[model samples]
Target: MKKHGVISFGEAFIDYISKDRSNTKFTQLLGGATVNVIAGTRRLGIPSYYLCRLGVDESSLFVEKELAREKVKTEYCVRTPSKKICRVYVYLNEQGERTFHSYINPTPDEWLLESELQRDLFENAKIFYFGSGTLFHETARGTTDRALKYAKESGLLRAFDTNIRLKRWESDEQCRETILSILQEVDLVKMAEEELLFVTETSSLEAGLEKLSGLKIPFLLVTRGSKGTYAIRSGSGIFVPAVKVNAIDTTGAGDAFMAAILFGFHEKGIPENLSQLEKYTQFANEIAALSTTEIGALTALTNLQEKVQIFKWF
Candidate 1:
């Protein structure tokens, strides 16, 4: 068998999205930043794998079934009775920007342990991707650390997305420290402009990049919604403008952008120069813009596959 594709590990949950600002009616859909990345990659014809500990609840079942339907391999996912699938309430404002209202978490401490990670999966994958969702807890943090170690040892490319949800962490300082701890280990990292500022403890984007320049990260992406994404490779930066779209919901746009970047890596390997990086960022921006034309994260991705030839665009 050939060693290929991406392996993602993190939280899997259900998102209850409000119909409007009224907050009266909501539609339940599969969500979680890491889940969106894995599913999005699969939708774009990348062989993807999801690794997480799932409970026996109906929500967990929904996540598993949906991942299966999306053709994402889940053989590495663990099943237990104690784990509870998390639920997040999302409210969309008039501008299609989403605000996470609240979270319903029954087992915040129950997470996949480091010992339970299957090493073979890392050995068989070309890229290993993750986000900040699961790093606040001890068990999940350990698992993430171990997984990264395995990925490095196996010579697999490591990618990190600063999908920061401040509500999940104890404090802003803790979130910054925890996320920065692993920056030196990853080959690629993606962050929104605000996230860049928050993590770097700087007020401006230029200051954030200057702070981040001290680190050895090979590739850094700073996404600035409509203005575009700034791709930083070996300290130099290039701003790639986003494709204009009437975004209906911007919930999973970042994950879509990430999935596109990972797909490019899986198919074409890491960008050799700044020009290649810019092309990849442009393709990612197109996908991200298209994703916002629908409601939910995964929902938007599914609609994108039907409306556009996703694989051909790359």
Candidate 2:
């Protein structure tokens, strides 16, 4: 049995989503790559922990309650005085696509300091997951780098998500620079088609793959939404199509996919079986496609039926 758990660090906040642009009524849901991944992992029966600091504010309190409800371990989560949780308003179009609008400035989640991290948490994990959100600000970058370095020293597999948010960064160049920096520390790298293009500054998939060839990550996945997920390992690329599902909202689908892949790793370590990788990839794609059948991120897989559906893919 795998004796280790997974630790993920990044943004944790509330997402206020609405279908109408009028913004009169909104449904609030916990939104963050970190939270979504852990939530999805736990639903898939993987031992997962979340590591992020929150304030004593109402939003933070809500997150606390939700984490408890989801049974996500929070031993490394920080709650400090006078801090506020980050919140974003997401608008969903008719096609289930999303657009983010930040109502508030100074997103507290971006100010995570190096002093706030718990290095001891790295000792008990098999994987450490971090993302582009952690690299946006100076303080959070310092903290993310420290935690990643500690995870590296402790021999934990590092998972990197290049899920790009254009609004978070000042320029495309800065985004590329930070992503390249994080790439050096990651063993497993995940991105969508657009992310691959922007990060590699390439117009085509082959060109993007060529750019990433030097990074030599053990597993590199590029998700192409409806088309499917593409995986590259040992210089070989495999394309797996997504499971057909009626999607209502596209939020958190990528996180769900990534979490399922991590669940595979935690269950049996990295794929030694070429066929096993395909199985896991298809399973993840199913989970992701099913995730869009609901309005909120966590709600898609929060119920027992949804959880059961996750295993049915395989």
Candidate 3:
């Protein structure tokens, strides 16, 4: 079989988002950095697969159903009674920025083990994507490492999104250390401006880029919300301004951006030049901006197919 689509491995949980700044009502939505990427890619008409262990809880059931509804293949997902899907209370401010207020995690250690990963999934995927959400735990980290090794051996393009949630990690230092360790292994990396600063322990984006330059990441993206995204290749960078929109919830914008880039890579190939990289980043910024026009991350992606058609790159 020909290698196709994207395979993502990480946490998939429920985001209980506040309806307003008043915090009176909440809405349940399917979310998680990696989940959003997989669903986002599938929404953009790419074949997508999710690899993780899910519990038999209500939230886990919701995640499974939502993934199925999105046409994301979940045949590789493991189901066990010991796993408990994490629930995050997302509080949005007046500006529609979200903060992970609290977590309801009954089984943090329960994760798909390294041995559970099926190598054929990596072999058949065009790109393998993941995030930092599950790396805080030892078992998941091991599994992620194993999956990365499989992806590399299979010659699949590997992508990492440093969707850092400080509250989930034991400490900022640990988060920075864990992420930096994995940088050299991935072909592409996407991070927010603040995450770039945090991971590099630098005060400015230039300094952070300088630090990451040492790792020689093939493609680097720094997303500055409302401002634009910076796409860096071979020490050179270009800023792609975001498409203006009436933002509702800024959540999953980065994932949407990642999905677009990965979608481009899946359809085309790794951008071989700066101009090609800019085109991909420009399209990604449009997708990211559009995702915030609705409340939920996945909810905003319903019209992504149209965007893909408009931004068709052949």
Candidate 4:
């Protein structure tokens, strides 16, 4: 049995999603990539913890309640006296695609920075996951930087999701600089096609791979929605097509994908062989595609039996 767990650091926000832009009947769901990943981990019975801040408001209260219900350890979650909560408005198209209009809270997520992060949390864990959004600001960025530095020094497996939300940053230049800095510390890097292009400043996938080859990240997983996921390490690349599902909402699919990838990595005993890596990516893509079948994130996970059944189709 794997005795370790995962510790994640990022934001926890509320998403207001609507099909019609003029309607007030929007569905309210939790909307932070880190939080969503933690939820998925909990559903898989993984011992996981999240470190983030929430305000003293109804949204915060609800989020706390939901986190507890999901069985994720909240010992590191900080509840501060801010009047606002991080928020986003998601708009979906007819094709189940999504675009967002965000309302960012001016408050910082660094309120938990002073709390002594239990070094044991990362020291004994199998993976330490972080992302770029937490580094978009100074206060939270400082906190995340310090924690990840600690995790790195302790020789923990560091995973980074280059979750690029262009609207959150001041400019593309700022995003590139901050994301590139985080890449230096990550053992595994997860990105989408557009993100790969943007991060590498290259027009083609081959060029992007060439640029990242110098980084020597142990594992690079690039997700191309619907078409499938691609995995490359050192010299080999493998493509895994997405499972066919009638997607209700694309929200949290990427987070679900990453969580499933982690689960598969743990369950299959992560291997260094190129063939083993390809096999894992195929399984991971199936889990991600299955997630989009339901409305909310992490609610409709494919169980062990279901996962086994799907592998036959692949």
Candidate 5:
């Protein structure tokens, strides 16, 4: 039997996130929602690839090294002639909520034109993953849109993490339109409770899930933070409570959650045949909880066997 793998499409950049109460020091880590998911999935022993562009700077080189170390293929990542790598500075509130300060680079997403895209890489992938921020700019928007169209038409399983960073978008209306348009092409969507409320303009999770389900999405995962998480398929809903953990920084928890779920499903085989969304959600929530036990997003995911051992003790 042939093995299954996922190909993630989106941006790869550095996150200059602060971890102190006095705001004394900031740390730079290789991060992007899509890349983080790929990394997290890899940590769970899943084979995946990150397809994106980065500057030919030291930071970009570090990202390449890290992805390679994680055993994730990077044949589709492009190195640009740009000045430096893109970075997002993160600020954490008292409640561990995250805020971003971004340095928008000039690397054009047109760099991902069909000439550069690894057709063989994508053609061999079982899943194609991306998020909304990649659709914010015209250059990236055009490239990702085309890639998504191709993925949908190619009969690949499409996953969308509706990672709506309001600051990156032109307007709420524009964000809705672009995201809604892309959702139609996606086979799965993972969204947070707040994002669901914001995107659907619904005050309740049930109503919000119903609205998203009406779009004909096959699998929908909704994370409700401390309250737990939910997954629905063809109107069948499954809920899993969040793992208890003292969160130091909540920045990458969602990415960890997304990756764990994908990893779980990938490990299990068929997404449509698996009625174990609840089990995956429970496992993913534990991964996300463990992620917040430390600062960096990818911290706890590194030692999966150890982490699973710890979870067993929990």
Candidate 6:
């Protein structure tokens, strides 16, 4: 079999989900921004690898099991009992929307240094995925930079998603600068509607799109929940409508979208024109819509293989 070519480097943590229908009592679930994306890729039949650390604690162990179940290549996963896994307390509203309150600060993932990243994996990957969570701290920021540097030197395609959590950033200015810096280097970017406003410092969608044109990223995918995605690739623009579904838990919908998009890129090279982008974006939208029909990120993904058989790519 051929080796997987997609690798994601970032934190992975346990989420204590509020089980109460009213959002009170809690239950545990695997939750990490980047991990969810990696899992989505694997579910979409894209061979992927996860690069991060985990301890022997129960939470860490749970993550280990989940990754194995997801079949993401874990050769780059480091094990150490010295640092415990990070934790996030997730509260879900009646609408199935969630708010995250994290605990166990400064956990093992924050300590992921450059030396820990696998140079060979970085060198071999066709596409490298990243989230903004690690850029908040100095240690991890330096570590992420090294991995990004490795990907760049190796000439691998780099993708970034502005999965911003205000609580994780040091300051608004710091968040803007760090994200923009990475944005400058990546071949593609995925941003939510609000993220587009913040990153472009614009109040309206049209203005934001105009500002993004300056970056000249080969592909800038701006996802508008329910409204669909806007793709700006090398100045050409295409809008793909969102697929409607009964959203139960939207926790990892964006990750699903990111995974599906990156998977499409892994399978097909960069879109040659708007028509090509529209086809891929439509398929990705369906992938993301199906993810929300269930409570967990990877829960509803078992059907992707079946869905792929029916949906032809253009």
Q: Would you list the clashing residue pairs of candidate 6?
A: none
Q: What is the number of backbone collisions in each predicted candidate, taken in the order shown?
A: 0, 0, 0, 0, 0, 0
Quote the positional error of residue 57 for candidate 6 in Å.
2.1
Tell me model 5's lDDT, rounded to 2 decimals: 0.77
Better lDDT candidate (1, 5):
1
lDDT of 6 by residue, 10-101 (tens): 88887888876576688877878899999988887777898887777777778888889888888787888777877778777678667765
Give model 2 RMSD, 1 decimal: 2.8
Candidate 3 to truth, TM: 0.94
- Over 40-154, each residue of candidate 5 has an lDDT whose tens digit, in order, gives 8888776788887766767878888888988989877777766366677777677766666556665543345545665666566677888986788887777787777677666
Which residue pairs overlap in candidate 5's backbone? Answer: none
Cα-based TM-score, every candidate: 0.92, 0.90, 0.94, 0.89, 0.88, 0.92
lDDT of each: 0.88, 0.81, 0.88, 0.77, 0.77, 0.82
Question: Rank by TM-score, descending?
Answer: 3, 1, 6, 2, 4, 5
Instruction: Please report the candidate that would top lDDT against the real structure.
Output: 3
Candidate 3 lDDT, tens digit per residue, 1-314?
78988999998888888888877689888878898889889989999999989988787889989889999999998999889888889787878777768889888888999999998888888999999976899999999999999999999999999988888888988998999999988999999999999999899989999888999999999999999989998778998898999998786788889999999888878888988899999989988898898877767778666678777744
Candidate 1 per-residue lDDT, tens place, 29-146, comes to 8888899999999888878999999998788888889888889999898899998998889887878667878889888888888889988888889999999987888888888999
Better of 3 and 4 by lDDT: 3
Better of 1 and 4 by TM-score: 1
Q: Of 5 and 6, which scores higher on TM-score?
A: 6
Query: How does candidate 5 fare on TM-score?
Result: 0.88
Judge candidate 4 at residue 243 and give its lDDT. Answer: 85
